[model samples]
Target: MKSSESRLGQWPLLAEAARRDRLGQALLLVGDEKGCQSAATALARWRLCEGSGEEACNCRSCRRQLDAHPDMRHVRPETKTIRLASVQQAVASSQSAPLWSPMTVLWFDPVTAMTLEAETALLKSLEEPEATTQYLLTAERRDQVLPTVVSRCQIVHLQGSIRASRPFRPEYLADRGRDLQEDLTAAAEAVRGRYLQRPDPRLLELFDVLVEAHGGIDRNLNQELTRETVAMWWRQTVGPD
Candidate 1:
Protein backbone atom coordinates (compact mmCIF):
# COMPACT_ATOMS: atom_id res chain seq x y z
CA MET A 1 0.00 0.00 0.00
CA LYS A 2 2.82 2.32 0.79
CA SER A 3 5.15 3.67 -1.91
CA SER A 4 8.09 1.84 -0.39
CA GLU A 5 8.39 -1.79 -1.43
CA SER A 6 10.83 -3.15 1.10
CA ARG A 7 8.47 -5.55 2.93
CA LEU A 8 5.35 -5.94 0.81
CA GLY A 9 7.51 -6.61 -2.26
CA GLN A 10 8.10 -10.17 -1.09
CA TRP A 11 4.34 -10.83 -0.98
CA PRO A 12 3.06 -10.22 -4.45
CA LEU A 13 0.54 -13.04 -4.12
CA LEU A 14 -1.10 -11.30 -1.17
CA ALA A 15 -1.34 -8.08 -3.12
CA GLU A 16 -2.80 -9.95 -6.07
CA ALA A 17 -5.34 -11.57 -3.77
CA ALA A 18 -6.37 -8.21 -2.42
CA ARG A 19 -6.57 -6.69 -5.89
CA ARG A 20 -8.79 -9.50 -7.09
CA ASP A 21 -10.95 -9.38 -3.95
CA ARG A 22 -10.14 -13.03 -3.49
CA LEU A 23 -8.88 -12.57 0.02
CA GLY A 24 -10.49 -15.03 2.40
CA GLN A 25 -12.17 -13.97 5.61
CA ALA A 26 -9.30 -15.45 7.53
CA LEU A 27 -5.64 -15.23 6.47
CA LEU A 28 -2.67 -16.96 8.05
CA LEU A 29 0.62 -15.16 7.28
CA VAL A 30 3.65 -17.34 7.90
CA GLY A 31 7.30 -16.34 7.79
CA ASP A 32 9.62 -13.89 9.57
CA GLU A 33 7.85 -11.75 12.16
CA LYS A 34 8.57 -8.38 10.60
CA GLY A 35 7.67 -9.59 7.13
CA CYS A 36 4.40 -11.14 8.24
CA GLN A 37 3.34 -8.01 10.10
CA SER A 38 4.23 -5.81 7.15
CA ALA A 39 2.21 -7.94 4.77
CA ALA A 40 -0.72 -8.03 7.17
CA THR A 41 -0.69 -4.26 7.56
CA ALA A 42 -0.60 -3.89 3.80
CA LEU A 43 -3.60 -6.19 3.44
CA ALA A 44 -5.54 -4.19 6.01
CA ARG A 45 -4.79 -0.98 4.15
CA TRP A 46 -5.73 -2.54 0.84
CA ARG A 47 -9.03 -3.79 2.17
CA LEU A 48 -9.95 -0.37 3.49
CA CYS A 49 -8.48 1.63 0.62
CA GLU A 50 -10.86 3.54 -1.65
CA GLY A 51 -8.77 2.95 -4.74
CA SER A 52 -9.56 0.14 -7.10
CA GLY A 53 -7.61 -3.03 -6.34
CA GLU A 54 -4.46 -2.99 -4.17
CA GLU A 55 -3.48 0.56 -4.96
CA ALA A 56 -3.92 2.73 -1.86
CA CYS A 57 -5.83 5.97 -2.51
CA ASN A 58 -4.98 7.64 0.78
CA CYS A 59 -8.68 7.76 1.64
CA ARG A 60 -9.93 8.42 5.15
CA SER A 61 -10.18 4.69 5.92
CA CYS A 62 -6.70 4.05 4.57
CA ARG A 63 -5.32 6.94 6.57
CA ARG A 64 -7.05 5.63 9.71
CA GLN A 65 -5.48 2.22 9.30
CA LEU A 66 -2.09 3.83 8.81
CA ASP A 67 -2.69 5.82 11.99
CA ALA A 68 -3.83 2.78 14.04
CA HIS A 69 -7.55 3.17 13.55
CA PRO A 70 -9.99 1.95 16.17
CA ASP A 71 -11.59 -0.35 13.65
CA MET A 72 -8.35 -2.32 13.38
CA ARG A 73 -7.79 -4.38 16.50
CA HIS A 74 -4.39 -5.89 17.16
CA VAL A 75 -3.98 -8.91 19.41
CA ARG A 76 -0.59 -10.07 20.67
CA PRO A 77 0.39 -12.30 23.53
CA GLU A 78 0.94 -10.30 26.68
CA THR A 79 2.79 -13.15 28.33
CA LYS A 80 4.48 -16.37 27.23
CA THR A 81 1.09 -17.71 26.15
CA ILE A 82 -2.01 -16.08 24.67
CA ARG A 83 -4.67 -16.39 27.32
CA LEU A 84 -8.29 -17.42 26.89
CA ALA A 85 -9.46 -13.96 27.82
CA SER A 86 -7.68 -12.37 24.90
CA VAL A 87 -9.22 -14.79 22.47
CA GLN A 88 -12.66 -14.17 23.91
CA GLN A 89 -12.22 -10.45 23.60
CA ALA A 90 -11.17 -10.83 19.98
CA VAL A 91 -14.19 -12.95 19.23
CA ALA A 92 -16.48 -10.46 20.90
CA SER A 93 -14.93 -7.57 19.07
CA SER A 94 -15.34 -9.31 15.73
CA GLN A 95 -19.09 -9.35 16.19
CA SER A 96 -19.27 -5.57 16.30
CA ALA A 97 -19.41 -3.39 13.19
CA PRO A 98 -16.62 -1.02 12.28
CA LEU A 99 -16.86 2.42 13.84
CA TRP A 100 -15.86 4.29 10.70
CA SER A 101 -14.52 1.89 8.11
CA PRO A 102 -16.60 -0.43 5.99
CA MET A 103 -15.16 -3.52 7.66
CA THR A 104 -13.25 -4.40 10.81
CA VAL A 105 -9.79 -5.94 10.77
CA LEU A 106 -8.48 -8.15 13.51
CA TRP A 107 -4.71 -8.52 13.40
CA PHE A 108 -3.29 -11.33 15.50
CA ASP A 109 0.48 -11.84 15.53
CA PRO A 110 2.65 -14.76 16.56
CA VAL A 111 -0.41 -16.97 16.79
CA THR A 112 1.87 -19.84 17.74
CA ALA A 113 1.94 -18.33 21.19
CA MET A 114 -1.75 -19.00 21.72
CA THR A 115 -2.47 -21.63 24.32
CA LEU A 116 -4.57 -24.66 23.47
CA GLU A 117 -7.58 -23.18 25.23
CA ALA A 118 -7.12 -19.86 23.58
CA GLU A 119 -6.75 -21.42 20.16
CA THR A 120 -9.79 -23.58 20.69
CA ALA A 121 -11.82 -20.49 21.45
CA LEU A 122 -10.38 -18.76 18.39
CA LEU A 123 -11.26 -21.78 16.27
CA LYS A 124 -14.91 -21.31 17.11
CA SER A 125 -14.70 -17.71 16.01
CA LEU A 126 -13.04 -18.76 12.78
CA GLU A 127 -15.68 -21.37 12.08
CA GLU A 128 -18.50 -18.83 12.17
CA PRO A 129 -16.81 -15.72 10.94
CA GLU A 130 -18.69 -12.45 10.72
CA ALA A 131 -19.17 -11.20 7.19
CA THR A 132 -18.21 -7.66 8.13
CA THR A 133 -15.03 -8.66 9.93
CA GLN A 134 -11.75 -10.08 8.66
CA TYR A 135 -8.96 -11.86 10.46
CA LEU A 136 -5.20 -11.73 9.83
CA LEU A 137 -3.12 -14.18 11.82
CA THR A 138 0.68 -14.25 11.71
CA ALA A 139 3.20 -16.83 12.87
CA GLU A 140 6.82 -17.76 12.25
CA ARG A 141 5.86 -21.26 11.06
CA ARG A 142 2.55 -22.75 10.04
CA ASP A 143 3.39 -26.09 11.61
CA GLN A 144 3.59 -24.51 15.03
CA VAL A 145 -0.10 -23.59 14.82
CA LEU A 146 -2.88 -26.11 15.27
CA PRO A 147 -4.04 -27.71 12.06
CA THR A 148 -7.61 -26.85 12.98
CA VAL A 149 -6.71 -23.21 13.29
CA VAL A 150 -4.71 -23.25 10.07
CA SER A 151 -7.51 -25.03 8.26
CA ARG A 152 -9.84 -22.06 8.55
CA CYS A 153 -7.47 -19.51 7.02
CA GLN A 154 -5.77 -18.88 3.70
CA ILE A 155 -2.05 -19.39 4.16
CA VAL A 156 0.54 -16.88 2.88
CA HIS A 157 4.23 -17.56 3.18
CA LEU A 158 6.67 -14.67 2.76
CA GLN A 159 10.03 -15.56 1.19
CA GLY A 160 12.37 -12.68 1.92
CA SER A 161 13.28 -10.66 4.97
CA ILE A 162 11.73 -7.19 4.78
CA ARG A 163 12.05 -4.02 6.75
CA ALA A 164 9.47 -3.78 9.56
CA SER A 165 6.64 -1.43 8.68
CA ARG A 166 4.95 1.25 10.75
CA PRO A 167 2.06 0.64 13.24
CA PHE A 168 3.69 -2.72 14.00
CA ARG A 169 7.04 -1.50 15.21
CA PRO A 170 9.84 -3.50 16.84
CA GLU A 171 8.81 -2.16 20.22
CA TYR A 172 5.73 -4.34 19.99
CA LEU A 173 8.03 -7.32 20.40
CA ALA A 174 8.41 -6.38 24.04
CA ASP A 175 4.72 -7.08 24.54
CA ARG A 176 5.09 -10.61 23.23
CA GLY A 177 6.87 -11.67 26.41
CA ARG A 178 10.39 -10.46 27.02
CA ASP A 179 11.83 -13.92 27.73
CA LEU A 180 10.47 -15.35 24.51
CA GLN A 181 11.85 -12.44 22.53
CA GLU A 182 15.24 -12.91 24.12
CA ASP A 183 15.24 -16.60 23.35
CA LEU A 184 14.39 -16.05 19.72
CA THR A 185 16.96 -13.28 19.42
CA ALA A 186 19.68 -15.47 20.92
CA ALA A 187 18.78 -18.38 18.69
CA ALA A 188 18.78 -16.18 15.60
CA GLU A 189 22.12 -14.65 16.53
CA ALA A 190 23.71 -18.03 17.06
CA VAL A 191 22.52 -19.42 13.74
CA ARG A 192 23.35 -16.20 11.92
CA GLY A 193 26.86 -16.20 13.32
CA ARG A 194 27.47 -19.72 12.07
CA TYR A 195 26.03 -18.91 8.66
CA LEU A 196 28.19 -15.83 8.37
CA GLN A 197 31.33 -17.86 9.02
CA ARG A 198 30.61 -20.60 6.49
CA PRO A 199 28.24 -18.88 4.04
CA ASP A 200 27.21 -22.26 2.73
CA PRO A 201 23.87 -23.04 1.09
CA ARG A 202 23.35 -25.93 3.47
CA LEU A 203 23.99 -23.63 6.41
CA LEU A 204 21.26 -21.33 5.16
CA GLU A 205 18.86 -24.26 5.07
CA LEU A 206 19.84 -25.11 8.62
CA PHE A 207 19.14 -21.55 9.69
CA ASP A 208 15.65 -21.82 8.25
CA VAL A 209 15.04 -25.03 10.15
CA LEU A 210 16.36 -23.38 13.31
CA VAL A 211 13.91 -20.52 12.85
CA GLU A 212 11.04 -23.01 12.61
CA ALA A 213 12.32 -24.76 15.70
CA HIS A 214 12.23 -21.47 17.55
CA GLY A 215 8.60 -21.14 16.57
CA GLY A 216 8.00 -24.62 17.86
CA ILE A 217 9.47 -23.59 21.16
CA ASP A 218 7.11 -20.63 21.31
CA ARG A 219 4.23 -23.02 20.74
CA ASN A 220 5.31 -24.95 23.83
CA LEU A 221 6.47 -27.93 21.85
CA ASN A 222 8.54 -30.53 23.64
CA GLN A 223 11.87 -28.96 24.46
CA GLU A 224 13.75 -32.26 24.10
CA LEU A 225 12.25 -32.78 20.67
CA THR A 226 13.27 -29.28 19.66
CA ARG A 227 16.79 -29.77 20.97
CA GLU A 228 17.15 -33.09 19.14
CA THR A 229 15.83 -31.56 15.95
CA VAL A 230 18.19 -28.60 16.15
CA ALA A 231 21.07 -30.92 16.95
CA MET A 232 20.24 -33.01 13.92
CA TRP A 233 20.19 -29.91 11.74
CA TRP A 234 23.47 -28.82 13.23
CA ARG A 235 25.03 -32.18 12.44
CA GLN A 236 23.80 -32.02 8.90
CA THR A 237 25.08 -28.51 8.33
CA VAL A 238 28.20 -27.81 10.39
CA GLY A 239 28.91 -31.34 11.57
CA PRO A 240 28.48 -31.40 15.35
CA ASP A 241 28.33 -27.71 16.24
Candidate 2:
Protein backbone atom coordinates (compact mmCIF):
# COMPACT_ATOMS: atom_id res chain seq x y z
CA MET A 1 0.00 0.00 0.00
CA LYS A 2 1.22 3.53 -0.74
CA SER A 3 1.60 6.08 2.03
CA SER A 4 -0.30 9.36 1.98
CA GLU A 5 2.90 11.27 1.38
CA SER A 6 3.69 9.20 -1.70
CA ARG A 7 0.17 9.58 -3.05
CA LEU A 8 0.00 13.30 -2.36
CA GLY A 9 3.44 13.99 -3.84
CA GLN A 10 1.96 13.78 -7.34
CA TRP A 11 -0.17 16.86 -6.63
CA PRO A 12 2.38 19.49 -5.73
CA LEU A 13 0.39 22.51 -6.80
CA LEU A 14 -2.60 21.50 -4.71
CA ALA A 15 -0.38 20.92 -1.68
CA GLU A 16 1.36 24.24 -2.16
CA ALA A 17 -1.89 26.11 -2.55
CA ALA A 18 -3.32 24.49 0.57
CA ARG A 19 -0.27 25.32 2.66
CA ARG A 20 -0.36 28.93 1.50
CA ASP A 21 -4.12 29.23 2.21
CA ARG A 22 -4.77 30.14 -1.39
CA LEU A 23 -6.79 27.14 -2.67
CA GLY A 24 -9.95 27.89 -4.58
CA GLN A 25 -13.38 27.96 -2.96
CA ALA A 26 -14.39 24.55 -4.37
CA LEU A 27 -12.58 21.69 -6.08
CA LEU A 28 -13.88 18.66 -7.98
CA LEU A 29 -11.54 15.77 -7.26
CA VAL A 30 -11.72 12.93 -9.80
CA GLY A 31 -9.96 9.70 -8.90
CA ASP A 32 -10.18 6.58 -6.83
CA GLU A 33 -12.72 7.30 -4.11
CA LYS A 34 -10.46 6.42 -1.19
CA GLY A 35 -7.59 8.46 -2.57
CA CYS A 36 -9.83 11.43 -3.22
CA GLN A 37 -11.29 11.29 0.27
CA SER A 38 -7.87 11.13 1.86
CA ALA A 39 -6.64 14.05 -0.26
CA ALA A 40 -9.60 16.12 0.86
CA THR A 41 -8.90 15.38 4.51
CA ALA A 42 -5.23 16.23 4.19
CA LEU A 43 -6.01 19.46 2.36
CA ALA A 44 -8.51 20.51 5.01
CA ARG A 45 -6.08 19.78 7.82
CA TRP A 46 -3.34 21.84 6.20
CA ARG A 47 -5.64 24.66 5.26
CA LEU A 48 -6.85 24.97 8.84
CA CYS A 49 -3.49 24.40 10.56
CA GLU A 50 -2.10 27.19 12.70
CA GLY A 51 1.54 26.43 11.75
CA SER A 52 2.45 25.84 15.42
CA GLY A 53 2.50 22.10 16.16
CA GLU A 54 5.37 19.66 16.14
CA GLU A 55 3.77 17.25 13.70
CA ALA A 56 1.31 19.49 11.87
CA CYS A 57 -1.26 21.39 13.88
CA ASN A 58 -1.39 23.55 17.01
CA CYS A 59 -3.90 25.58 19.04
CA ARG A 60 -7.62 24.73 18.96
CA SER A 61 -7.24 22.35 16.03
CA CYS A 62 -4.65 20.38 17.96
CA ARG A 63 -6.84 19.63 20.96
CA ARG A 64 -9.40 17.55 19.10
CA GLN A 65 -7.11 16.55 16.28
CA LEU A 66 -7.70 17.33 12.62
CA ASP A 67 -9.92 14.25 12.45
CA ALA A 68 -12.30 16.10 14.69
CA HIS A 69 -11.72 19.56 13.33
CA PRO A 70 -14.75 21.66 14.28
CA ASP A 71 -14.74 23.61 11.07
CA MET A 72 -14.50 20.54 8.85
CA ARG A 73 -17.63 18.62 7.93
CA HIS A 74 -17.52 15.36 5.97
CA VAL A 75 -20.88 14.62 4.40
CA ARG A 76 -21.07 11.15 2.96
CA PRO A 77 -24.00 8.99 1.98
CA GLU A 78 -25.62 7.49 5.07
CA THR A 79 -27.26 5.00 2.74
CA LYS A 80 -26.82 4.19 -0.93
CA THR A 81 -27.88 7.72 -1.81
CA ILE A 82 -27.33 11.11 -0.24
CA ARG A 83 -30.68 12.61 0.62
CA LEU A 84 -31.69 16.18 -0.01
CA ALA A 85 -31.91 16.87 3.73
CA SER A 86 -28.31 15.88 4.33
CA VAL A 87 -27.13 18.14 1.52
CA GLN A 88 -29.27 20.97 2.82
CA GLN A 89 -27.79 20.62 6.29
CA ALA A 90 -24.30 20.63 4.87
CA VAL A 91 -25.13 23.75 2.91
CA ALA A 92 -26.37 25.47 6.03
CA SER A 93 -23.21 24.48 7.84
CA SER A 94 -21.05 25.81 5.03
CA GLN A 95 -22.95 29.06 4.99
CA SER A 96 -22.10 29.64 8.62
CA ALA A 97 -18.80 31.27 9.54
CA PRO A 98 -15.82 29.30 10.72
CA LEU A 99 -15.36 28.70 14.44
CA TRP A 100 -12.00 27.22 15.48
CA SER A 101 -10.18 27.39 12.15
CA PRO A 102 -9.52 30.15 9.64
CA MET A 103 -11.89 28.48 7.19
CA THR A 104 -14.56 25.79 7.11
CA VAL A 105 -14.32 22.80 4.77
CA LEU A 106 -17.32 21.02 3.30
CA TRP A 107 -16.25 17.61 2.04
CA PHE A 108 -18.49 15.34 0.00
CA ASP A 109 -16.69 12.12 -0.71
CA PRO A 110 -17.88 10.60 -4.00
CA VAL A 111 -20.43 13.19 -4.81
CA THR A 112 -21.85 10.58 -7.18
CA ALA A 113 -23.80 9.15 -4.25
CA MET A 114 -25.95 12.22 -4.18
CA THR A 115 -29.45 11.74 -5.61
CA LEU A 116 -30.90 14.04 -8.22
CA GLU A 117 -32.63 16.27 -5.68
CA ALA A 118 -29.63 16.21 -3.42
CA GLU A 119 -27.44 17.38 -6.28
CA THR A 120 -29.86 20.19 -6.97
CA ALA A 121 -29.71 21.32 -3.35
CA LEU A 122 -25.93 21.15 -3.38
CA LEU A 123 -25.88 23.17 -6.60
CA LYS A 124 -27.69 25.96 -4.80
CA SER A 125 -24.95 26.08 -2.21
CA LEU A 126 -22.34 26.18 -4.93
CA GLU A 127 -24.22 28.99 -6.61
CA GLU A 128 -24.05 31.03 -3.43
CA PRO A 129 -20.61 31.43 -1.89
CA GLU A 130 -19.42 32.26 1.57
CA ALA A 131 -15.97 33.82 1.85
CA THR A 132 -14.70 31.51 4.60
CA THR A 133 -15.99 28.17 3.36
CA GLN A 134 -14.16 25.78 1.06
CA TYR A 135 -15.90 22.89 -0.67
CA LEU A 136 -14.21 19.61 -1.57
CA LEU A 137 -16.08 17.12 -3.72
CA THR A 138 -14.72 13.73 -4.75
CA ALA A 139 -16.13 11.41 -7.41
CA GLU A 140 -15.03 8.03 -8.70
CA ARG A 141 -16.64 8.89 -12.06
CA ARG A 142 -16.98 12.12 -14.04
CA ASP A 143 -20.15 11.68 -16.10
CA GLN A 144 -22.13 10.77 -12.98
CA VAL A 145 -21.81 14.35 -11.81
CA LEU A 146 -23.94 17.17 -13.19
CA PRO A 147 -22.24 19.47 -15.68
CA THR A 148 -23.44 22.45 -13.66
CA VAL A 149 -21.69 21.13 -10.58
CA VAL A 150 -18.55 20.31 -12.53
CA SER A 151 -18.45 23.80 -13.96
CA ARG A 152 -18.54 25.35 -10.50
CA CYS A 153 -15.17 23.99 -9.39
CA GLN A 154 -11.69 23.29 -10.66
CA ILE A 155 -11.27 19.64 -11.70
CA VAL A 156 -8.41 17.48 -10.48
CA HIS A 157 -7.76 13.93 -11.68
CA LEU A 158 -5.76 12.19 -8.99
CA GLN A 159 -5.28 8.82 -10.61
CA GLY A 160 -4.06 7.54 -13.97
CA SER A 161 -6.43 4.59 -14.46
CA ILE A 162 -9.25 2.67 -12.89
CA ARG A 163 -7.80 0.09 -10.50
CA ALA A 164 -10.43 -2.40 -11.54
CA SER A 165 -10.12 -2.97 -15.28
CA ARG A 166 -13.86 -3.02 -14.87
CA PRO A 167 -16.25 -2.05 -12.08
CA PHE A 168 -18.30 -4.62 -10.07
CA ARG A 169 -16.21 -7.51 -11.20
CA PRO A 170 -17.58 -10.57 -9.41
CA GLU A 171 -14.34 -10.61 -7.43
CA TYR A 172 -14.02 -6.85 -7.12
CA LEU A 173 -17.68 -5.78 -7.36
CA ALA A 174 -16.66 -3.74 -4.42
CA ASP A 175 -13.73 -2.14 -2.79
CA ARG A 176 -13.11 -4.31 0.23
CA GLY A 177 -16.82 -4.65 1.01
CA ARG A 178 -17.43 -1.14 2.33
CA ASP A 179 -21.13 -1.35 1.43
CA LEU A 180 -22.66 -3.60 -1.15
CA GLN A 181 -25.04 -1.19 -2.84
CA GLU A 182 -22.81 1.84 -2.62
CA ASP A 183 -19.78 -0.11 -3.74
CA LEU A 184 -21.60 -1.56 -6.72
CA THR A 185 -22.89 1.87 -7.72
CA ALA A 186 -19.45 3.40 -7.30
CA ALA A 187 -17.88 0.66 -9.33
CA ALA A 188 -20.23 1.16 -12.29
CA GLU A 189 -19.83 4.90 -12.05
CA ALA A 190 -16.08 4.43 -12.09
CA VAL A 191 -16.35 2.45 -15.31
CA ARG A 192 -18.44 5.27 -16.75
CA GLY A 193 -15.65 7.64 -15.82
CA ARG A 194 -13.12 5.50 -17.62
CA TYR A 195 -15.30 5.43 -20.71
CA LEU A 196 -15.67 9.20 -20.63
CA GLN A 197 -11.91 9.66 -20.58
CA ARG A 198 -11.24 7.45 -23.64
CA PRO A 199 -14.65 6.85 -25.23
CA ASP A 200 -14.04 3.14 -25.21
CA PRO A 201 -16.74 0.72 -26.34
CA ARG A 202 -15.10 -1.98 -24.24
CA LEU A 203 -15.73 -0.01 -21.05
CA LEU A 204 -19.46 0.10 -21.74
CA GLU A 205 -19.51 -3.64 -22.31
CA LEU A 206 -17.61 -4.16 -19.06
CA PHE A 207 -20.16 -2.01 -17.29
CA ASP A 208 -22.97 -4.11 -18.75
CA VAL A 209 -21.25 -7.21 -17.48
CA LEU A 210 -21.15 -5.71 -14.02
CA VAL A 211 -24.86 -4.95 -14.10
CA GLU A 212 -25.78 -8.45 -15.26
CA ALA A 213 -23.62 -10.03 -12.57
CA HIS A 214 -25.28 -7.81 -9.99
CA GLY A 215 -28.68 -9.02 -11.13
CA GLY A 216 -27.60 -12.63 -10.87
CA ILE A 217 -26.30 -12.09 -7.37
CA ASP A 218 -29.50 -10.36 -6.32
CA ARG A 219 -31.43 -13.49 -7.28
CA ASN A 220 -29.34 -15.53 -4.81
CA LEU A 221 -27.29 -17.27 -7.48
CA ASN A 222 -24.24 -19.06 -6.11
CA GLN A 223 -21.80 -16.25 -5.51
CA GLU A 224 -18.77 -18.44 -6.17
CA LEU A 225 -20.13 -19.51 -9.54
CA THR A 226 -21.17 -16.00 -10.37
CA ARG A 227 -17.71 -14.72 -9.54
CA GLU A 228 -16.10 -17.41 -11.63
CA THR A 229 -18.36 -16.64 -14.55
CA VAL A 230 -17.69 -12.93 -14.23
CA ALA A 231 -13.96 -13.53 -14.00
CA MET A 232 -14.06 -15.55 -17.16
CA TRP A 233 -16.03 -12.87 -18.93
CA TRP A 234 -13.56 -10.25 -17.75
CA ARG A 235 -10.59 -12.29 -18.94
CA GLN A 236 -12.16 -12.79 -22.32
CA THR A 237 -13.20 -9.16 -22.56
CA VAL A 238 -10.14 -7.35 -21.24
CA GLY A 239 -7.51 -10.09 -21.68
CA PRO A 240 -4.57 -9.89 -19.25
CA ASP A 241 -5.19 -6.47 -17.69
Give the number of the best model, judged by TM-score. Answer: 1
Q: How close to the true structure is residue 125 of candidate 2, measured as C-alpha lDDT? A: 86
Model 2 worst lDDT window (10 residues): 1-10
Q: What is the C-alpha lDDT of each candidate?
A: 0.65, 0.65
lDDT of 2 by residue, 1-241 (tens): 1122332333543532343343568888877867786677666665565554223334567456655777878888897988889888878987777887767888887789999999988888888878888888999876789989977876655553223333444456323444443344445555555566887778667766655554444345676665566567666755645
lDDT of 1 at 154: 73
**Per-residue lDDT of model 1, residues 70-149, tens digit only:** 77778888978788898899779778877766678887777888889989998999999999888989999989989889
Off by over 4 Å in 1: 1-10, 50-56, 65-67, 160-241
Per-prediction TM-score to the true structure, in the order listed: 0.60, 0.59
